[model samples]
Target chain A: MKRNVVSLTIAVLFLTLAVTGVMGFFLPFNILTVSVHALLGFVFIGSIALHLKNNFRQLKNYFTSKTALLVILCVAALVAVILLQPKPVLAILGLSKNLGPAADRFELKDTKMIYNYTPAPHYKMQLNFKGGRAFDAEKPPRVAIWLENTSRYHLKTLYHSKAPDAQQMLPYWHYKKSEYEKYKAESEAAEKAGKKQSEDVDALSSATPNESFDPADYIVPKDPEKETPYRLLIEINAPDDGNEHYPDQPSLVYVVEVDNKHPRSYQVLDLVGYPKSEMDEEEGEIEWSLLYADGTITTAHDLFDSALLLIERSDPIK
Target chain B: MKRHFFVISLLMLISVWVFFAIKAGEEKTSYQSFQGNIFGTRYQVQYHAHEQLDMDAAEIQAQVEKLLQRIDKIASTWKANSEISRYNRAVAKDEFQLSDELREIITLSEQLKTSTGGAFDIHHQGEEIDVSAIAKGYAVDRIAEYLHDELAIQNFLVEIGGEVKARGHNAKAEPWKVAIYIPPSHSHIVGPRVTLSNTSIATSGLYFRENHIKNAETGHAPDHDLLSCSVIHPSNTTADALATALYVMGAEAGLAWADQNEVEAIFIKSDGSIIKSVQAQR
Candidate 1:
């Protein structure tokens, strides 16, 4: 009974190996075939162990025989022939030329080979600010400044104040408001047509689309927002600052910046600024000036003076 | 006789176990990748085989380098001593003897030239043949073939510069994923990912370091209005030639041509709009 069981197991394992091995050539590499081939391999090993135990003496005599030695020598000779005659074998395989100069005849010179690669550099201007008292000498309001690029894209903001929880400032105008209107129009159209909205429109509806919003939400940010000491969190205002104000509401709001020395009922800055294109060879600098809400004109320097900073170069702070 | 039968069976079983053992060891260290310079750019080869392979990685690399070096010798216009250069330097009317490999490339180029309406021509002024556009693709195909046929490596990815030929599953037993970069993108945000299985892909664009691709008729590079053109085909050589031809033919014409020819392509416009070919959409 034990002999029958061992013979049956060996037969099954052999069949599995044969079937999977043949199928491997005809069929594309698949997980099922590969898994079965691998699993059967382990079973084959165990079955072969049992087979060897039942016929150890015979198996040892077979390896010691002249036929086994001759087979091993033949296999070794074949491998040696293949290794030594690579070019000829490759030529027969249609992978090499039999007559022409061999592939390694000519060596590539070091002059022709490029090893190093340098990426294009990005240019940025830094600004430094000194002590500038707020509009009120007693209760100085936090000063907020917005920086926009040549394309009117809001680059960043620098909020200078004693109150870390100061209310966020607003722009006289925002480019995102236009984008929101555009998205709203498309969403409405898609809804009217009874079609599923695109992922962009869906995400735009679900989340507030601000300067910080990235179109590709599937990607995780490499540097996630952490409470690092030196890291400054800049809050980009929404297109429409939904009816929220602060006398002292502690809630951030878009407020029109004003100069000092004016009373509590001072004029708001309502300015129109056109960003200069960086591509223009003659006029590369962005020129923007502030205007009072009461139609009073102000110089560009006074509004941007505090934000103008010098690029600092220092050794590591040990 | 019974003892002889047991001996033969045991011998066969041991051979099978040894085969499986070697294959398992390879699987544990599967998907061997090797990279080097080829065709004036970088070439990378990655392959995995469950079966026992006769040639190790060093042998495979040696073979692959030989094939690519031969291609450079036959097709490279930069090499003065190359066969193509020799043919170019010969009298216009002289019958130039061509190698089997060069002859094959010329034949393929002739077909592409006819189909692309002379846009993909290899010959310049009807004498100097410049097969650089298609040669890289051919090299990629040759390496992929070496892995598939000579080495019997089915699961493999071969990339020469931006041209790629991929087959079967990756190390994770999933289709190989390739990223298509958006043309003229400011940031290095991840582009759209396409799964490649037994297919070839090649991208042609003005954004590359070299401005070699040009309109054959005009003898000038095409306008940069169309950022890039990427073609996918079963044949890597065809995909490479099509990509270059389509880039020469602006975005609209390229899309139309790709549609008519029933070839898969992706056109990235300067304005950041991506247009997919009929096959790609399907």
Candidate 2:
């Protein structure tokens, strides 16, 4: 029973060594595998000692014979040859998949990481109104804002009340998307019919607001109970300059404001709106809302729209 | 049996000690490098040293980022709220106040513009001012200085984008070798292989962006006969700016300018021919 137990333990440890030796090729060279292999190797050596002890009498007789001497000599020679030419030996044995330890073989020869990489700077700005005595918490304010470049080129809008009217006023985005779909269908139909595609002039043109009354020009809302009071936040990411920081300056100034009560200028600006098609497909795309200083309000469908609207309404800091 | 076991254990201990000793000795001559992204471009730093670097990886990265952010505040036009952007947007553009760094860049730009005969104009009247051409090179030099002076790194190669600054011997104790590739056209050809030591190389290629190198005279992209131009100098700033300036000057005039100035330049022509400046012939 003692001999059997010793043999079994030795067999299990030798099997572990063989399995792990094979696994060393497929698995990445990490501490876990290396330590396990080394520890198991030490245990396998100890197990061999135990095996020798169990069969000391028979082992002594066997080792003294000519066959044992020849076997030992052959093993030593093979080990020496393998040490000198590991690759060829591995190739012959069909174990040349991972020729060496990964760390030594796959080390970077050219460049080193001196610093951890980071992307370009992204910025955010917010407008918070510590509500004055006359301020209404229920009614959100009307807001419209856009950004311009250094040359006064109209880059984008930071906030727009019209785009954000879906929750409180109307689903203008749905209407806008429907109009785009309608136009696209017509255009495709025209192509199929081999006719020149017609442009939607009416859809492209801005709808004329009531000449008698201007929504943006209206500083005060009629019913305080019906409005949702909120604060405005704007975020913008530095656009890719073909993987470079071009010396081009971003002009961050919002010029148009409705209420004189809270007047402040901001410089961080630029946002792109997700197209209506994408907005419909993706849920939780529109997260934030923009509240104007006046009693008007708008919903920001995404960070891009909010950034655009925020920049559009912001007065340039002098 | 007890004596043999003791002997085997002693041999194993000796073998382990020898292995560790050899490993410790090898660590002295090993090559190490650091890489990161800054100023919208990738930067790689490789150094061969007898000892470990003065700064760890995290410390080095943090310092580089901090330096880049400082430079961005001064020179980046992408940050609308940055000092440079504010300066650009100022109504009082004429005689506007300048930071020390901005003032230095403007002065250098003016000098280069004069030297290159308007071939290196960064600021144009009634147009947006841009210093991207030279700022990257300057940043490269700054990093090299930080590595060499602060970190006590002597043998190092620093590369930002296609701009490279190399000093001392490489890991194999050889001059740093750099290859200039021609802007890929119909035929994929190589420009020149240059050996650099305590020198910088900056290449300007037209294949990446059309009209990126605008002619100050015409206020449009130059219709140059050259596909790419590379300049090597001790100063990264000069190497970077001159490469762009030479590209703008075109093949004939650009080559003539390089020859006259005795500047090392390699111009890859649109016809897939390579031309070397007088100094580059060495």
Candidate 3:
């Protein structure tokens, strides 16, 4: 009776282990499958021990026989092959990983898109442009927002209307952008030739001129700071609404100077000037001379009823 | 005496087998972790293997980053030159051609919008389509697939921002467990926990920030009593969109929608009450 019980226990445990192992292999990783397989495997060892003890004499006869030696040799060979981690065996195991439900495949490719990876700014600059009576949704006016240093050097473009004729619509911004690009190209060429570039070009290439102007590094100096105020500019132009000033009305530029050290809650932009329509023949560039809005400026001034530049400062002093 | 020797030898063999088995289980317990930043948010991936992993941890992380970068290039609205941005800026909306990836995402978004009764919409304020709500979740699903299909990583967890997808068992040979955090306040109080195996969980709410989620019809942030809503699904993209939609739906309507759709979800009310959908009760 004891031998029968031991034999039956081995058979039952072996059946459970086999079932759980197969389930664990086929099914997605789950606690039940793994725990049952691992825990029952230990129990199976105990049952096998009992079975061996119950039939020691029969097992001894079988072990010394040629059949037992052959079985042992076969088991050893299988273990050796698996331990070697051959490519074919690994590939088979890899296939088992995908035995679960199929995943959604994305045929993604590199889109060579140019992305601006600028660091998050300390102050949030929200530009609120209210469309005036002249502002038409059908023929929306092209607008460009950019930042410049106190000395009128172009710093960066905050926003630009994605119109094909954006350059013609915002000539003032286009001229500044062209100037910046030329400087940037010259600096790059000089750097490639291992030549010491001009100090102005080097300053232009850096994110900001002075260390204090670095928005990311908010290091408060003990002494009263001599901070440089940056100018925010916006250029707006309406197409096909030509006024008496020119066939295609020149773009209007708005300017606001902001001091980082002495931050303000709100700063209204002042109507600055429009870039001269004619290009300078000698310089091969659009003349920097700006024309003030006059009687002919008419509907172009009404493109934006009001422009508010709200700045939220993250400084401790503020 | 020979019989005793044979029995002892058999016992020794059993002992060796048990020892090796225990060692293998131990090996599975020690997991390798990889973490990085993507989509202006942090992400983490944890996985384990019974045998040697085919790729190094760094190499796998690089591949994951590359995959995320590609997705960002296609879908990120912040990128001025991205495919989605181009579509948004296009004068003729109908004429604008979308890439296969963007088209698929937009189709999924449209289906979600219909299913949720316009509570979830990517088209915002005429001609603008923002997939910010579902893009992260889609990215999470993509990474999970990459790990499973490309690397053959069976046991892994991928989390980007608050969106998460887990598969198989963890290093401890147990189902992956994730915690859902409630918003507004009360850090000490543990909200809820979800056991994920081949599933995802996404939570959306106005927590520690200004209200960014707006009603699709009204074009303004919805006035609601619920603080946060979390959804669990096999696909992280679906879970993500549902979370945002449920938040807009509030607790009552959200619960009803979740039950009808058989979506497992948990909603935390403003007055510190928790509500679970019928499926989530499990």
**B218-263: candidate 3 lDDT, tens digit per residue:** 7666688776788999998999999999989989999999999999
Model 3 residue A35 CA deviation (Å) reads 65
iRMSD value for model 1 = 15.8
Q: Per-residue CA lDDT of candidate 1, range A1-318, in tens?
A: 277898999898899889886666455446677689889999889888888888889989999999999989999998896655454553342322121211112111222211111110111113223222212224333333443321133333333233543333332222223333444454344333322222211000100011222211101111112100111111122122222232321112222321111212222222233221133332343333233322121221122213222222221111
Model 1 per-residue lDDT tens digits across residues B1-282:
999999999999999999999988767677787766545455678888455887777777878887887887788775567898898898953577888888898899999999988878888876778888898889889888888887888898888876878999778788887766442232232244577889988888754332467687777778658767789898888998889898889888888999999999888776667889898898
Residue pairs whose backbone atoms clash in candidate 1: A127-A309, A128-A309, A128-A310, A135-A260, A170-A254
Per-residue lDDT value at A76 in model 3: 99
Lowest summed lDDT across 10 adjacent residues in model 2 chain A is found at A201-210
Q: List the candidate 2 regions with Cα displacement exceeding 4 Å.
A: A1-318, B1-30, B49-53, B125-127, B183-187
Candidate 3: stretches off by over 4 Å: A1-318, B1-30, B49-52
Model 1 chain A poorest ten-residue lDDT run = A201-210
Query: What is the DockQ for all candidates, taken in turn?
Result: 0.02, 0.01, 0.01
DockQ of 3: 0.01
The alpha-carbon deviation from the true structure for residue B111 of candidate 1, after best TM-score superposition, in angstroms, is: 1.5
Docking class of 1: incorrect
lDDT of 2: 0.56
